[model samples]
Target chain A: MTTGAYPSQSTARLTRERFRAGECRPTAGIAPGMTQTNLIALPRDWAWDFLLYAQRNPQACPVLEVTDPGDWHTGLAEGADLRTDLPRYRVWRDGVLAEEINDASACWEVHPDLVTFLIGCSFTFENALLEAGIEVRHITDNTNVPMYRTHLPCHPAGRLQGEVVVSMRPLPAAHIARASTITARYPGVHGAPIHVGDPKALGIVDLDRPDFGDPVRIEPGEIPVFWACGVTPQVAVMASNVPFALTHAPGHMFITDVPDSRYHV
Target chain B: MTTGAYPSQSTARLTRERFRAGECRPTAGIAPGMTQTNLIALPRDWAWDFLLYAQRNPQACPVLEVTDPGDWHTGLAEGADLRTDLPRYRVWRDGVLAEEINDASACWEVHPDLVTFLIGCSFTFENALLEAGIEVRHITDNTNVPMYRTHLPCHPAGRLQGEVVVSMRPLPAAHIARASTITARYPGVHGAPIHVGDPKALGIVDLDRPDFGDPVRIEPGEIPVFWACGVTPQVAVMASNVPFALTHAPGHMFITDVPDSRYHV
Candidate 1:
């Protein structure tokens, strides 16, 4: 999906070139500052349910926009073309695992329509926290925000329903409060801590080993603050077991033209 | 639902008491220091569409919290009961005015299956504007903010769709800019101006004749700044012609515990 001509590679150009060359993988942290979104290329039949899914599960699915079918450019975010701008895409078949692909054109269909969802990513507020002199444990440890599947069920939208997934961060009590307050302002980025203390309360049994991502050390007085993770859509996608679906692998996010600051609640 | 309480009585208490007393009237001037919310209550059947609608049309529908069905306490705001708190409710059936009621208890069904939307109001920012020494035209004139139906189509949400409605205020260019920059920080209150200068650009034919609210004077050298208004939900709710719906009257709003300052984007 990223292949393109690079007359002169700039930050955006080089980044696009890398994606175009297939040199960039799903997890590449190539660019920063710009907003990153979640991708959901589903059949036209399922687009409505998926959109409802995002709306019902806002913390995990704070949608930036849904592009007009097959029209990939997100005018909200610097006219970035969703089809080719993204590093990669996945094809899901009726809730079943399907072949992973780089472009949709090969598998694109008018009836099995695809919708693009731009979700709020923590990367925006993670930057805000770091700039605010607050430490981001995940970045400090060079690990993904430890995500755990929770007992908290997402509000259902047709067949797209599943348990809420959350990412946890450990911080001192004061910083936890500060982070909660600072982050809550950006509703675009999951807005505040859903749970601030015991992981077991959210039904997770262990902190050292998460369902996804590496766990960081929790210092003496630090407590955990959990936020709804973007992985929620994948959970919903999986729960639906639709014949087809698409999502970015793990940390691979769809970069958007919207500035991180634009997501304030 | 207005039963068990004195209608129109001050309730000899605070916002909650007055509201609980079937004072479901204009919340515009109640609870001065407290935050007031705009309401959009829809049946659960249409929940996803309206939720998606709010998400797509944030400048106009910046959600404070989309409540979990049957459970009304926002847990974020003043923790007022969703079903009983607002002094009044307007029921829209099949896209037409059906009836105005004091409480939605008669309309309430368990699962009662419904979705409630809380939106930030201009009042929060108006206080800030007043404190900054800027004269709020509507407040000075003792009238609703001049609102008009714009040519802009609100990003559609299923069948739930309509044109964008903008509230306008005529102020000096410097004040308008400062107001934009200031309100730009408060995305909760419809954020900054969507358009400035020629109202026609937004498909507004006459600034003196508004679709809703009293028109304010536009002095020489003053420009009209238009912002996405909370009235948007009313337009969508009506335009969509959903089987059932509810919303607050113009200016009247639900007071919340959230401080206006907390909404700084």
Candidate 2:
């Protein structure tokens, strides 16, 4: 449900309650002003490599918080249990999708060496962009943000190595500078746009057919702006072929207690 | 040797040459415009906890780069061997000071699981402050910057936990604003001052005495400015009492290839 229908704090509580009860749905447009996070849980043996990967490629994987081995609670939210806080989760085994589940507690219990990482999501900055009078077309159209795989190679860390993945938002040519300036303040999120124009330069042959998410129309005089997507790490993790890994489904995020403004410089 | 005697680039190379040749000395003012880093090497088993500790307490441990397991080469400095590039090293065993040596290669070789971490140093921001017309009393007086053990406890991660340590710089009341603004741009370093005017606010009793480093004179009109020190991670790592750890001796840092200006927003 959209945050407009409920009070901000109660909306977040309601979202968590729904998720805990196995109500599987996307988390977009929920808990306005509250930060949402991309979740990744890996075995303790593989966590250090992923942490190092995030450190090396911060633009793509801006970590908000990380839990100790086998811990599910994060300081980012009060009484938020990571095992059941997200609306949906993607379980991977040997770099392949094993199953989609609403509750990951069973999987987590089996692998007691799991460590959770709360990574900053672009949705936090989208809220700021909306407040600044910049239109986030996906939110306006009530659809998933368009994302594409780029040729830009991320710096390799241990066994985690892959090309960067980015989300696209088409904006008017005039709003490009203001949008970048506004988002640059929130480096805790994905930060500013990585590319302003020419998807071809990023090795994306077709803007209308995205590798992930629904493609949005680019009207006359509007340019597609690309920001590093949280998917980059997920893709890298999958490519690394770890024995088992879990991540929040696309558009299905873990809502955090941290305000969006906290990330603003 | 001070950087005033050679060109900036040559000075960095010269400093590294001397360090590699076993010229044991403090690195302050040796490469004026270049960035210097605090080094910490820990076994792979403990590296995850240390990485988590650094992530939780980024202000105190702004990690510049973390090497893979048993790796010592860092991209921060080209051909700068982490094993011998630093003028001095402190070997810790069971959290106690084991020995001070000019080289840590032998120690690292013995513990093949060692992973090196290069953390940002305040010397980079100090250079920025000096360029902005702020006086760094320690550099002017040719003494080590004053550091103190504050009552501010760091957010614990895994087995690592300790009080936050701060390096004090006395700035004129009028320059505090500018110094903070300038340093805030460089979050790679300690970012802005954590505390501004009063020493007692941070549980620091006397300005003339410090827990580490030589105390500097706090002038009559100067306000004591405190920035989170890199020594904090070392303190926490020591307190964790890991089997073996290695860190750079105070003021004897690893000279990085990155320029100070790169960190500026």
Candidate 3:
């Protein structure tokens, strides 16, 4: 829908309308200052475990809000219906990819015990990094931020457990400290960089080939920095082998009324 | 057994020793610089709702760590037993004050399904405030910090729901901004003053008579500042009328290996 091209207060509403009308697309750079979230829906029985998992590993899965069982609305975005507001959704059956859908309302109706979780996305903090005059390679290159699976294991909660996943950004060595300081303020998002320098430290052999998303160019003086990715929970949830689950497609986030400034210290 | 008189690295260990020996006393000023926590033990069944409630209200109930069902040890403090480390514990029966004891191990043994929650206490931030050269009135008076029930209702989760409870500190008008900034750095420990002036704004009437803790003197030109108190969860748990629950007694806290600086931004 290219809602980012028309940045305004109405961007969130317009983007949501397009998603409601079956237009599936990435949500990056849309609605400028507004916060966007990663969505995960699970049965009420597994919701507690997932909630605890988020609490135990907040940096990878910073939960903005969790809806009550069978509820689809979030207070972060007034009047926004979670069931069909996001551009696209991925449904999983027994930890395997089952279907890709424009809206999750049908799946949710079948799983009446569903609980929706709104998790903070790195896009919010990336906006802050841009405002701080730090260049974000992906946005400049018009591609999704490169992400990789890390050797770091997340603290397990109930049946949910998996390796941590991180998103990468490359910036000049001189700007690393400032970039960290700027992003650290938005803990609601992914917060500070988890690793800087050697990608091998996190077990990533090649920066050009990412586990998820697209790789961006690393200039001569630039160093790759990594932040915990919201995808960590999706991987963990899939590994748990739950009977069914619903999640926002990679880069297709649910826009909220909350502003990026709301997360700043 | 008054460990407050012995402020040293060994204070936490010595305090735990005293607690093990059945010396029940308040924990205020016992282990300076060491992070202290509020304890809440609930049945595994009710633990999910309480954990969700804490997640929904991080300022009031900043969860440092939550134990797996029937486990008493926490990573926050090595070798520290949640059942017996705190100098005193309060047992609630059907939402009413049942008994105050030296240790909760007995009640825990009887319940078999208890899940312990270690929640961050304001004492960590209070230590930062003192280091910032701000005077904490109750500490100066060698009394418990004055806490009051407020009109602000916490976001309810399942059976847990109640008004927010705040701890009051009267600081000079000029220091309010500095105090807010200092405390804001410690989001793990309540973080910043929720109310700066006008106690009546939070439905706090009669500053001299707080609903919890002792009243502290407020000199002229000083304004009453309020921070979300750990007591908020205790109040909510009580109102929910859980059959049995255990909490650290007012002013008695669980000493952890974590330092106040760990929470700093």
Q: Give chain B TM-scores in order.
A: 0.85, 0.94, 0.94
lDDT of 1 by residue, A93-130 (tens): 66555775555565555433566677777766776777
Q: Model 3, range A1-265, lDDT digits (tens) per residue?
A: 1223334447777888888888977777778788889889999999888988988898999888888999988887767889898988989899887998987889777999899888989988777777878888888888887889898999999899988899899999999999989888778888889999989999899999998778789889899999998888778867778788899887789998777777777
DockQ (Cα-based) for each candidate: 0.26, 0.57, 0.60
The Cα error of candidate 2 at residue B32, in Å, is: 3.2
Interface RMSD of 1: 4.0
Score chain B of candidate 1 by TM-score.
0.85
Q: Write the per-residue lDDT of candidate 1 for residues B49-111, one digit (tens) a residue.
A: 776688778888887767666557674444467666777677888888778676667666633
TM-scores for candidates 1 onward, in order: 0.70, 0.93, 0.95
Stretches of candidate 2 exceeding 4 Å from the true structure = A1-7, A22-25, B1-7
lDDT of 1 at B82: 68
- Stronger candidate by lDDT (1 vs 3): 3
Off by over 4 Å in 3: A1-8, B1-9
